[model samples]
Target: MRPTRAKITDAISAIERCFLRNQDGTNSVKDSTDSLSITEMTELLESLRGSIQRAVSVEQTRKPEFDIFLLTFQRWLLTDIARDQALLCDLLLPILNEALPPSASITPQTAPFVEKTLQFVRDTILRCSVAKDLIGKHMIGRLVATAVCVHASTMLKRQALDILNSLLAKSKENKALLTSHTCLTDLDNLVHLLKNAGDVELQTQLVELLFRICPKPKQERLQFIDTLHLPKIFADIRGDYFHQDCRAFLNQLNAGNDGVLKTPKSFRLSHAECVLGDTTSSLTLNPPDGADSLWLDFNTSSLSILVMIAGGDILSIELAFSKVQRWQVESSAGAFLPMTPIRI
Candidate 1:
């Protein structure tokens, strides 16, 4: 016989009881979590995650059981129940995707849940390498989309960017897997999203994201960079003191100032002196101040910066280089000033 609403309610209540916080204040999921064997845990996880996926399909996000389901899966993760196995990764991916689907309407109430859900996943991955790599393989695109989704909540965008930053930093594996033309499109999309955003902190976060996902061997960057043409937008925002870091990031990606230069004024002079018959000798780039220059301290050479013809209102920041088309500049410049810009 088909299950009645009463039976389903009872089943849901029972699962909810397993995950709810205790009045005693200990980790509530601990006792119930301790009771499951690997096989039983796996089966329960599949069931819970599947229920969530089904709820998402029906647009039932308003229901309380939607949260109950996520709580159950999240509680299972809080324990050592499945520790980095592909099975756990596999189960979690669908639940996460359902939580923040690329094409979902995000109302204020639903938005926080999505943002918090992403934060939970990010925190979980931070604790396990196997989980990090596994999720990176399949979730990179979705995460990028989340970070750049124009209509999505800012908290969601920032949180998704944080997770991407960590995964991309872990090693060459994630860098190679994530830095592709497909992924670059999302970066471009984010740039467009923030083109008119007045929120300085959000703009700063996007700059941070750019530093994180910037591809290596910039020759491989065209598929992404070429598609992003925001010269006018960048030019408009460059004058704002709050936008200096964002301008610096674009200057590096577009102008090749990915740090490493010692003195901005002198560097410009030397650069000008080197070029024979340069028409833009008159073209001025207002570089950063001598005491505090805008420099990018990338952690790896595996990370590459795109060759953008940087042209915002800032003089030294703007560059007129030869038409190399898509030249790559890899930076390993350490010992740089700490700078912060906002998001994608």
Candidate 2:
């Protein structure tokens, strides 16, 4: 017979009642189940997993038992029950993926549950070494990246990004694994979200993660950098907190490619100067106080410049350059600031 909602609720309630809050605010299983062996605990989770799988498949949206099930797991995690090997990865990871499938629609009611489930996963991984080990063993890097790059809910995306960062920080191999799994579409989605991201911390973390994965050798980077429109997005979003990272990313990409520079026709040189030493190089454009946009091309090397309304009324532009003999800047808006323009 199919599992009824009442039956699932009763099962979850029974599981929940097995744990009680201690005087120290920590949870512990009641004496009756406290002595349960690892095999018995695993069996209990397996039973709960079967109920959750069946119930969630039957009712994709608004299942109270599902909420209780996650809470029961969360409470269970707070106790010694979670320290056992393979229990978290074996039981929880499947339920996590089921709760937030990549293609599932995230209703407002469902969004909170999704966030809650992801939080549980993150917390489990962070607090339990055994669970962290499962991240690599199970190859769930792609699953976490999908949440970051494909999911619609910002809350869920943020949660997943945190989980991704934690895993990447712990394992060097995961950096390569995740980068290999990420495609052009994933990069495009990440850039799109960063462009519209209102949270400063989110933008910072996302940019840092992008930088970590994107700065490959010329052959590897040229495949996606141009296709994802990263340069255009970088140029467009300057003066935000991540401006330096954006500029540095471009410089890194430019350093790798040896092709001739491609300059747009609308660029007009106002001022360009090349200093020989290793301090830093900057391109300053003074566009008639209220000018809208500016374009410049470094024809000497493989660097192209595209600037938008950075800082809204500030016309000064600064960029770090290396090994370039010439810098050419052009303004379509107004006359240049009279600095000598250099050409390679």
Candidate 3:
């Protein structure tokens, strides 16, 4: 016999009332929180599952109404304004599998309903350690791939990334799934979007993801570096990697000014020399005392010489050279002259 619209509405209202009562301390539902002490949340979830299954199996011709009920149930699961239990997640699995076909045909009005269902699961995994563990055990890669393929939104994509990241972090047991080529490919594409899509928060989140997923070896770091031009992107964001304290000396040198004198002599140069030149040629101008270094400009010209002067009588001598050549003599200041002196 076909269930009337009024009957279905009443059932939905009853379930909603249970949900609200659970939240508001009424405890009307006979699940774990009430008289059905041994029943557990999982059992309640099973009952919901049986109901959805029976509704769907009644008749193929009645699918639309069944779908409506299923959609409403999903909406409640996602955003009931009450906390859901593990049983809800267990009940959701079969429904998710069954709802795929109908979800594909969902209208704009119904899209949020479907999306909220996915968001709820993701939020549960993120918010509760036990829920995350349950998802890591039961869902993880499978549902994540479904969400990524079915829900085409930047927000959903970000949520999927977050879920994957959390799963990978909490349970290193899923390394094979997390590191699979397909998963990595999706992550790579998402990282590209975050890095280039003008979304600062997304980019920040992606950076954290990268730190979590990227391996701890220098080779892996170099591999990531070679793949993306993060240095260039972060260069303008002063005090990032380029301006770290370890590289503060380099930043000062690039600023074309004598940086702090932690060392007796300092070099000042342009960005090009620091990034492109060899180590020997990229040294600081006025090399520190007892320091044998060359400070060459981008044009490969010596900027200054820091040779020891007797009794601390240091001389600041600027060589004027017109062409690329080497001087073969040492200056009176004990600095090495180029092999072939250039005309100045």
Candidate 4:
């Protein structure tokens, strides 16, 4: 027999009472002295879950009223009284995901409610260890990613990114999930944000987050390379700025001079240079300091010829020719230039 409205309402009331009792410490679920029986709690949770599922399904196409019901359910779940938030989260996640497509036609006022419901779900997952544990095995990541892409706000996008980051930290399997269609699309959007965002602090956090989530081996390298297209999004300095240390590091790398410059052992650049040329002077190279400036009189149609240096030596060479795409140099040393901007 179909569940009556009274029956559903009664079930919801029972769950709400259980939540309230737990919060007031009168009916504590777990107590060293006198704990509530697990069987009783389990039965109540199952009943609540069933009733909520039915209610949401019954109200799915109802628009405004349905939205109100969902919001009520969401608010109740989020409030601390519902100590069994994990159980609610488990039941709600899939329903929310499935409900989204049909609700796409919902009115603007209802849309925010739907989105907020989803956000509540996401936030709950983040806050609850049990919910977080279940996320990798379910569609939570994909669901959150989808919501983020649909919503244009930076705040929502950041929430989505935080969920992904948490998932990645939870397990390797979650990291693999990130590359999936729904997650990847969201990531692409996030990458776009990181590339375009002008805020220094946000960019730094995003870059670091991207670096942390990036897979090891070739995938990590490839992702970093792709990020080069938008280089301005990351912060180059952390503490007191100094260029001398950077110059020294470059000089050490160049002469094959110390352990720091050893191939594959220390950071080394393949080429470095600072070249300047105009339309008339083909590509010409300026010699080292104190030496006659070497002029390459070769005629090239291009207006500019970049100075080239090899073997990753000389602070100046490292500063000038380092890849603008991958590396971000931040130093206050007097020897080297203030900051070298790399594309990657």
Each model's TM-score, in the order given?
A: 0.57, 0.57, 0.44, 0.45
Candidates in order have lDDT scores of 0.51, 0.54, 0.43, 0.41
Please give, for residues 1-344, the per-residue lDDT of candidate 1 as tens digits.
44544554566567556655666877555555434456765665555554555555435656555666555556666655646567656666656777674744566646755775676677664664365667778677777777766677666777777777777775566777665555666666767654433333355566655555545444434434455654433332322453554655444434442333211111111111111132333321222344223222221111111222345332212222331122222222422222221111
The per-residue C-alpha lDDT of model 3 at residue 11 equals: 57
Q: Where does candidate 1 stray beyond 4 Å?
A: 1-9, 15-34, 215-344
266-319: candidate 4 lDDT, tens digit per residue: 222222233332223222134444432221111111111222234523222222
The TM-score of predicted model 1 comes to: 0.57
**What lDDT score is found at residue 270 in candidate 3?**
22
Q: Is candidate 2 or candidate 3 better by lDDT?
A: 2
C-alpha RMSD (angstroms) for model 2: 13.2
Candidate 2 per-residue C-alpha lDDT over 188-280 given as tens digits, one digit per residue, 9 for 90 to 100: 566666544433335545666665565446655555456666663443333345544454444443443223333111233444444433447
Clashes of each: 18, 4, 4, 19
Cand. 1 Cα-lDDT:
0.51
C-alpha root-mean-square deviation, each candidate? 14.3, 13.2, 18.0, 15.7
**What does the lDDT come to for candidate 2?**
0.54
User: Which ranking of candidates, highest TM-score first?
Assistant: 1, 2, 4, 3
Off by over 4 Å in 2: 1-4, 24-36, 54-60, 131-133, 136-151, 181-185, 195-201, 214-229, 232-344
**Best prediction by TM-score:** 1
